[model samples]
Target: MKVVCSYCHRLLRESPGEAVGVSHGMCPECDAYFAKLWGGLKLGEYLDLLPVPVMVVDGGGRVVAASERLADVLHRPRAELRGLRCGEAMACSRSRLPGGCGKAEHCRECTIRRTVDEVHETGRSVAGARAWVKTDAGRVPVTISARPAQGFVEVTLDEPEALAGALGGHAPPSRR
Candidate 1:
């Protein structure tokens, strides 16, 4: 079997026999791009080291900081995202209601919000949770994973395409 880079579709390596033995490595070009983008910054200082959009939130879901990728995804400067609630920062449509983020009726079922709450309560990290956000275009599905680190919940957001190849082509729920 041949392992390939998800972003560039370039061959990374080859493996025979056990499928589990296949090494997930990126090609040189993609490696350098990620190295240049994320190298040198320490974890607490920059969640931006991750290729996906990320946010560091407090126990109550307030945004303590965000990654550069997150800023790009939100189309706003990182500074503007600081101090907002997670739902507010991500602009979950439910946030628009009078109750705001956690207080909103729909928030209890929101994977992102629920994951953050669970992490805060149990100090356990969660991975590959599916979540959906109501955007102007429609509902956009995302794979949201989070970990407790440096006194904050570091949440990472991955697009469907990013997870598809890794998850054996089973994509997350699609935008409606």
Candidate 2:
């Protein structure tokens, strides 16, 4: 049988007398790397270690945890972001409405909300979906990606040139 690293997809080995079929396993290098990076870390800590802006949201769309990068991108403290709805964390103008966040009528069409909901409901990932969010600073364009993780959904945001000015002329770190 053929064995490949599940994390990096690198070929490990092929048993001489076995049938030719791929089997997934972690390569030693990847195993050690992941162990060093995530061995004893909790979910929230792991999120912070990621380079890109990411947040983990519960089924109700409340942020359970967020990366420091996300807090930086939203110009809010990490402590303030937790337990708030996604729209509220992003400072969506409509999120401050009488009903708040997801309760606003305009929220029904929110791309980030819809992406998270779809991933949670279907256990599928949505990648690089373009969205325009109406924030206190006005509408900003962002690329959103979401994937179901355990019982929650992990959402990532990519703001291109739009946030450069807000970030003091430096572009947000690359997702890669």
> Against the true structure, whose TM-score is highest?
2
* Residue 47 lDDT in candidate 2: 89
TM-score of 1: 0.65
**Regions more than 4 Å wrong, model 1:** 1-45, 160-176
Task: Write one digit per residue (lDDT tens) for candidate 1, span 103-127.
Answer: 9889888888999999888889999
TM per candidate: 0.65, 0.75
Please give the CA lDDT of all the candidate structures: 0.74, 0.83
**Clash totals for all candidate models:** 0, 0
How well does model 2 score by local distance difference test? 0.83
**Clash list (residue pairs), candidate 2:** none
lDDT tens string, model 2, 64-145? 9998878777767788999999888877789998899878899899888888889999999999989877865678788889
